[model samples]
Target: MLTLRDYDNSDIEALLALANNKLVSRFLVYTFPYPYTRADAEWWISAGVKAEGDVTKVIEYNGQFAGSVGIARKTGWRDHLAEIGYWLGEPYWGNGIATQAVQQMTDYAFSDLKLQKLYALILAPNTVSMRVVEKCEYELEGVLKREVFKDGQYYDVHRFAKVLKI
Candidate 1:
């Protein structure tokens, strides 16, 4: 079974081990450090996990740390919206873990958090993620050309969003 829960110190080792991979970090934002060191994991557990206006959680699969999922609520005029992001350990990729985690987060955002909309900004090259969001019923809002510069190159960004019906 897969679950989303609070981050704890026990996740440090597994987080570092699963996160320290180029393939996993390739499509992620630049802030998600490639090396993913012990200090990074410590900081994440100590500080990053508790960011204000953000709901971050550890993805647990059968009692093991599988990955992470989170949503950052927009401030001020866009307070009803939040940006959702998630990533699964490379070993757990093809098992539909990400899709399930995202679905859970989306439900949490709309029901628990009272969010009106949730969106994901996926790099254009990440077709897998696009498919994931598509499966979750997120509509393609638009595309921003060359909006992201990562790994010393530029890439387009695909914007996908799902809005609450009520």
Candidate 2:
């Protein structure tokens, strides 16, 4: 079973253990940092975890901190839209954990957050993540050409979205 919970001090060790991997960091935005450290987890638990509005949850499987999933609401003209993101520990990959987490989070965002739509920006090389969102019913909105530069190279970003039924 999988669950999403608010981050707490107890999660620090497992958070660092999973996030420090280069393979996991490579697909994430630069904000996630390459060599995730205790300082980063501390800051995240201290400040990054949203106390209100949208939602950011630590992904847990069988009572263990496994990864993170969150929805970030847009401001200004796009207030009804939210950007969702997630990552699972490398060992947990290929087990459909991300897909389940995304589905559960999407339902929460629509029902509780009152979001009208949810979207994700996936790097071109991250076909795995793309498939995950697709499996959760997100449709491709479009592709941004060479939208990001990471690890000394540029990559296109694929945009995927799902509109809330309400």
Candidate 3:
């Protein structure tokens, strides 16, 4: 079963290992330096445990530290909306982990938090992550052409969202 809990300091090693992998970093906004270090995990875990209520955690499969799924509430004009972001360990890909995790997270976002909209800006070539969003019932809003510059080149994003009527 998938569980969304707060980050525990003990998970530092596993979290860093997952976050710094080449395959995992490919779709993320920032790429971590090679040779994922223990200190990296320590810093991440320390902050994650204290991230207030805006961020959330998920343990994949059986203790794989699977990945994190977060909702950053937009301020100002987009205050009613939240931006969703998530990633999984490379070795844990091909499973329905991400789909299940995001679905569970969004359900709470809509009902518990009373959020109007939740969105994801998927990297252009990340088909697997896109498919996960699709399976979870998030519709493709549009393509944000040249929206992000990552790994030295600009990439287009297929914006996806699931809106909950208030």
Candidate 4:
């Protein structure tokens, strides 16, 4: 069984272990730090998870910390929208865990958060994530060429979104 819940102190070790991987951080934003250290995990659980206006949850599979999923509300004129993001441990891949988690987070963003739209900006090479959002019913919005500069190289970004029915 998979579940989403708030992060706790116990997750620090698992989080550090799973997050400290080049394969995992390669596709994520630069802020996600490649060498995800204990301090980073500590700060994430103690403060980052509680960032104002954002909702983050730990993805637990069979009672073990498997990954993380979250939504960040857009500000100002775009307050009606939010950007969804998620990542799973390499060991947890290919099991439909990310797809299920994205579906759950999408529902939560629309219903509980009352957001009208949720979107994802996927690195062009991250086809697995593109498939995940697509499976969740997010439509391809557009592609921004050379939009992201990561790992000393420029990569395209694919924007995908799903709007609330009303």
Candidate 5:
């Protein structure tokens, strides 16, 4: 069974362990530091985990911490939209975990958060993540060509979004 919950002090070690892997960080944005350190985890917990309007959750698998997912509330011109992002440990990959977590979070974002729409930006090479969003009924809105520079190269970002029924 998988569950999503708030971050706590006890989650530090598990967070560090799962987040420190290069494979897990490869498709993630630059903000998710590759060499994931204790300081990084601490700062994330304090600053990123529980933002005022956003929903950030730890993915707990069978009672153990495995990954994280969240819906970031947008502002200014995009107040009705929320950006979603998630990552799981390498060990938990390909077991339907990402799909399940994404579905659950999407529901929360729409129903509990009362957001109008949710979006996810996927780097071109990460087809698995693209599929993850697709599985949750998000539609491909467009592609931003060479929008992000990472690993000494530029990559296209595929924008996917889903809107609430009403």
Candidate 6:
């Protein structure tokens, strides 16, 4: 079973194990360092501790840290929109775990936070991640050209969003 919860200090080690993989990091927008360290994990938890509102969350599978997911709200006309980002451990990939975690988080963002919409930007060539977003019911809004730079190259991203009916 999959669950979404607040991040805790003890999760650092396991979280680092899941996040440090180069294969996992490649699909994500953010670039994790080559050797992800405990200190890196500690620094992340420190920031998570300060995160409030639509900010941070951890994915738990059977009481252990499985991965992480969070949202950041946009400004100006994008105020009501919050962009979500997530990644799972390489060992836990291909299961419905991410789908369940994202579904629960999106529900909370809609019903609890009163967010108008939740969205994600998936890099082109990451077919697996694109499928994950589709399974979550996040429709592809459009393709963003040269929107993000990763691995010293600019990649086009597919924009996806789901407006809440609630």
Candidate 3 local lDDT, 1-166, one digit each (tens)? 7778778887876787787778777777663445568877786667643554476675556755788887878777787789888888887788898899999889989988888999998988999899999998899999999999877899999999999955
Instruction: Give stretches of model 4 more than 4 Å off.
Output: none
Number of the top-ranking candidate, with lDDT as the measure: 4
Write down the TM-score of every candidate.
Answer: 0.98, 0.96, 0.90, 0.98, 0.96, 0.92
Query: What is each predicted model's overall lDDT from 0 to 1?
Result: 0.93, 0.93, 0.81, 0.95, 0.92, 0.83
TM-score: the better of candidates 4 and 5: 4
Which one wins by lDDT: 1 or 6? 1
- Residue 159, candidate 3: Cα error in Å is 0.7
lDDT of 3 at 30: 63
After TM-score superposition, the amount by which residue 137's alpha carbon in candidate 3 deviates from its true location, in angstroms, is 1.0
Cα lDDT tens digits for candidate 4, 71-155 = 9898999999999999999999999999999999999988899999999999999999999999999999999999999989999
Error of 4 at 14 (Å): 0.5
Model 6 Cα lDDT, one tens digit per residue, 1-166: 7788888888888988887888878878564564677887898888844555456788888887888888877778778889888889889888888888888888888888788999998889888877877898999999999888888899999998999874
lDDT of 5 by residue, 1-166 (tens): 9999989989999999999999999878999988999999999988878787788999999999999999889888888889999999988999999989999999998887788999999999999999999999999999999999998899999999999986
Higher-ranked by lDDT: 4 or 5: 4
Candidate 6 residue 146 C-alpha distance from true site, Å: 2.2
Q: Score candidate 4 by lDDT.
A: 0.95
Q: What overall lDDT, based on C-alpha atoms, would model 3 receive against the true structure?
A: 0.81
- CA shift of 149, model 6, Å: 1.9
Our tally of clashes for model 6 stands at 0
- Indicate the residue-level lDDT of 87 in model 6: 85
